[model samples]
Target: MPRPRTVLLTGAAGGLGTLMRGLLPAYGYELRLLDVLPIPDEPAAITADLADKDALRAAVHGVDAVLHLAGISLEASFDKILRANIEGTYNLYEAARAEGVRRIVFASSNHAVGFTPRPMGTDPLIPVATPHRPDTFYGLSKAFGEDLAQFYWDKHGLETVSVRIGSCFAEPTSVRMLSVWMSPDDGARLFDAALTAERVGHTVVYGSSANTRLWWDLASARALGYEPRDDSEPYAEKLLAEQGELDPERPEHACLGGHFTTDPPIWPH
Candidate 1:
């Protein structure tokens, strides 16, 4: 398929969405913004919950693809996770399918495989095909999103790229982040590649920069024309010095999802 010129960017008011808003336009995409919360500067951004089927269908209409960044990002109760991440993603897919939109870049998080062991010294990088061992309801929701993406592809002929993103921040702040951090610029590059790749057919790829301490493989991402230009190496010395290196014996450090694996937040009553 030709390059997608117009995209519906969900979660427009969230941190990653806000960062992407400043970045993706450089690649020539005209973004249609959507969020449950109000977008600060843009008057035209769609303001509605994902459960609003009519609004979701309308948001997807005329857009070439969707960058699905909406939903509750952190660990939440099963009820919240169901409404925001699981059902919300399902709603988005139905809307996209109903509108005849072809491609969607789903923001599947690393926490989806939060219990998988991290690569240690000379250990093979974690493969994209790792089995699901979700540590929290939030992670379980992401795993469900991947399945949802696959079902949409097989049953409805829609294409999706399930990006299992790591810590996408301006800089690495923790010892674990040194291994998982994806710079904002590299995040944009990966998303751009996902948007333009041909015959993706529900491809799942890990998202992060070329970090020296990377725990997972980026080969899948690279195969989609994603050439990451940044690395978390420069931040290594500072983070390591402050927090010290991760100990494999520690449960959190042993897994790819860090604290989400060993110390997930307790669900609220």
Candidate 2:
């Protein structure tokens, strides 16, 4: 299929969403922003929860594709994760199907496989086929999203790219981030690739830059024509100097999920 010109950008007020809002327009995409939170300058944004079927349908209407980035981003209580991530993603897919939007770029997170052991000596790069080992309720919700995308593709013939994003920031902030940080420029490039790739039937790819210390494989993403332009190596010296070296014995450093692995899981009363 040809690249989509008009796309629905959910979670427009969120951090990554806000970044894409400023960048995607340069790629010739007309974005229809949606979020429960009001976008600062986008007065035309669809201000509604994803659970609102009517509003969601309206948001999906006439859009050629959807960039689903809405939902809980952190390790929130299970109830919150269920309501916002699980139910919200389902509602979005239903709306997309009903509105005849075939292509979607789901903003999945590395948390989906957060429990995977970090690479040790001679450990192979983490592949896209890695089994689910979610570290938290938030991570579990992302796993559900991936499966949801797969089901839509199998049953409804919808196309999706579930990007298991690592740390997407301007630069690496910690020693652990050196293996996972994705530059903002590369993030935009990957999303563009995911949106434009042909014949991607619910593909999943690790969303990180071509860092020297990268833990996950980028072959899947590369197959979609995603060529990341940055690396976290340059930031390594400063980060390591400030934060010191990673201690493999620590649970936070022993897994890809970092602090998420050791933090007490939150739950709703």
Candidate 3:
């Protein structure tokens, strides 16, 4: 089948979503924006909570594919995570299936495997087959999303690509981010690959630039035709000079998820 051209982009107002909004257009996609929060300068962007099933179905109608990015991004109380991340994702998948959307690109997080030990020295890169060891309610929700994607593909013929994204910022600010940072351009490239890849039943891939200090393997991502261009090494010197080298003794630096494992963030009520 030809690549899906009309896509429903959820979470249109968030940091990453906004970046995608600008870049995906360059790849010949007609994005239909949706989010609970209103997107500026977009009168057509749907502003509805994920809990609203009726609005979700309406938002997904006629879209060739869905890029599901709406959810509580940080560690939150279990209830919040359940509602926004867990149940909310379910609602979107249901809507997509009901609307006959061909595929979904799920924005999963590295925190889903937060407890996994980071590769040091010659240690092997973490594989996509790594078992889930979520360190927080937020991470748990992402893990749930991954499982849900698989279930949908198995039973409902809904294809999905669950991207375990690292820090996708314009620049690497901290030593930890240097290991996992995905540049804005590389992120766009990964998404484009995911959208166009063939025979993706329920693929799982790490999302990051070709960083020199990468902790996870990119083979799965590359299988989808993703070729990450940016590297965080240029910024490594400044970050290392300021923060010093990662000490294996430090709980935060010992894992791929960084401080998220050491101190899980709770959403402020």
Candidate 4:
């Protein structure tokens, strides 16, 4: 049997973080959870601000590898993204280097390329290797993470993989989701590929499902041995019936689900 690796997972209290926390144990990993809030059930969790160098160092100590999911998640002010996403990610990479951790799996998002046109509902899903066309501050923050991954892999000996997650949800909720939905089971597959793949240095891959209707080519993901079984296309008819059609010309509908292209932006007023 393979030895259990110590996996330090940040943001264990958040949605995706929580999902990964429960799943890591099943994958033969000794899990260490981290978040600003207290971990549920008081499992082995570190509560601290990721931007605090000393705190991050403490969290990284003795962990063989890291799954960095901690960061501001949505379209927020530049200040929030800078502190939580940018600085916090930097702190993790530095801490990982100091602790001699071997690898890191970063949680990037589809928003990183939100400016690119999402082909119409009739078109195939875009592939994982698309060029980044960020649409919001949050998207830019994820882009920074990708760049940081490259720098760390080049300067230090650390191996890094950036998973640009699409819409991760319990189920497809809207018309746009037909192209973006990523189920938890599929997410686990994506992360598993990142964790155990061979010779992946600072590579960026989309986190999506194996839907036949998906637009993106998953050849890069397949190279890492990721085999997603779920498909978002099944929910297409139902979601479209409920939400009605969005103007394909609208930025939100036209490109990358209008996440960055939406008018007025979905931010606090």
Candidate 3 residue lDDT tens string, 72-163: 98888888889999999999999999998889999999999999999988999999999999878899999999999999999999999999
**CA lDDT, every model vs. true structure:** 0.93, 0.92, 0.93, 0.82
Candidate 4 residue-wise lDDT, 1-269, digit = tens: 12329888898888899888767677788888899999769656789988789988988899878899988777788998899999999999999999998889999988888887876656666776677778888899998999999999999978888988887788878777777678988888888888888888888888889865565667778888899999987788887788887687655777884646675254433
What is the Å distance of residue 38 in model 4 from its true position? 0.8
All models, RMSD in angstroms? 1.5, 1.8, 1.1, 2.3
Tens-digit per-residue lDDT, 1-269, candidate 2: 78799999999998899889988988889999999988887899999998899999999999999999998888887788999999999999999999999899999988889989999888999999999999999999999999999999999999999999998888888999999999888999999999999999999999999999999999999999999999999998898889998899999999998898888345431
Cα TM-score per model = 0.98, 0.97, 0.98, 0.92
